[model samples]
Target chain A: DAGITQSPRYKITETGRQVTLMCHQTWSHSYMFWYRQDLGHGLRLIYYSAAADITDKGEVPDGYVVSRSKTENFPLTLESATRSQTSVYFCASSPGTGAGPQHFGDGTRLSIL
Target chain B: QQQVKQSPQSLIVQKGGISIINCAYENTAFDYFPWYQQFPGKGPALLIAIRPDVSEKKEGRFTISFNKSAKQFSLHIMDSQPGDSATYFCAARTNDMRFGAGTRLTVKP
Candidate 1:
């Protein structure tokens, strides 16, 4: 496919374990975002990157880490996974911050026990 | 704090009826509004969008009503169908895009 894709569509890990979810896009977008969708709370941004090596914290960044070493890849890491972190994680990319609608991946369903 | 507020967490509309989802934002800087639709096991995709410059925009059976003064926007689906059953999210874009809590819409056939 030509759009964005997330690895390990479904993941399960224990609390305190280190887990990384991978996201890759073929569009070479300048902006990439990571968000977690939970019941009642909707979707909340976790982290985002403006460009390669330019990542920043989002609304809920605690317990999560992200790095954008390449324009096409942005990976999110849970340094110490917690049960509270169990949610559907979505990765999206936009041509730029002020550009058009963002394109989202299939999303990674992560379960922490 | 929630930047955008959506009403009626869940909605059920009879087929061929109108389905409306409303949202309000607190930020005046937000200029762009978009609605997303998501099905089970699928990612949300842009359904429709509107800019502050326009009061309304329609694409086929979907329409977006924007009120810049009230900082409110809404999505209206005409002639709703079973295919329209999905989660809808409204988002506003300022320096960043903030999404609403989302509405689970069911179009009963």
Candidate 2:
């Protein structure tokens, strides 16, 4: 409730379907990020937001879309889910874009079949 | 291409022993290096961090040894305990952050 929280701790969906993963932070951090973790690959950033209405792509943002309408909410949407997109997604927030420590959410385990 | 590379995908150690995890980075612009610890079913939390200007930083029983020339850094846990068993991640940061593959450490009780 006080820190960042992600919705749908577990999710199962089919290919070519649209799915959205939600992230909310109570700290109102200026920066928020989304990452997908896979075996051996670690955590690859998908998208990041510097502030409300501003978002940018990260290393693995190809199939993912993110929007931050409000400072407290950043949701990641899979336009067309694919099997390769199945992974544990984590949301993080930081006060600024500097080298500050980021706070991470518990993460959402998404499975695409 | 991976910007950060980590080793010993997994490790096992006895209680009271030392646990070491190494990481290497190719980027010189990285100004910050941080280590994160993650428990099962939980998100990763920052354990220790160091700036490039500092070669070594110690906190409690954990230490970070950094080599600026070699662009390498390591995390050492002294007096390992079963409670320390978890996945540890090393990360480097510039304008954005890049994380290492991660190492799963298991300290036997």
Number of the top candidate by TM-score?
A: 2
Q: Considering summed lDDT, which 10 consecutive residues are worst modelled in model 2 chain A?
A: A94-103
Tell me the lDDT of model 2 at A65. 91
Query: Which pairs in model 1 have colliding backbones?
Result: none
Against the native complex, each candidate's DockQ, computed on alpha carbons, is 0.65, 0.73
For candidate 2, give the docking quality class from DockQ: medium
iRMS per model, in Å, is: 1.6, 1.1
lDDT of candidate 2 over B39-107, digit per residue (tens): 998888989999999999999999999999999999999999999999999999987889999999999
Candidate 2 is scored at a TM of: 0.98
Query: Can you give the lDDT of residue B80 in candidate 2?
Result: 96
Instruction: Give residue B13's lDDT in candidate 2 (0 to 100).
Output: 97
lDDT tens digits by residue: candidate 1, A24-97: 99998899999999887778889999999999888899999999889999999999999999999999998888
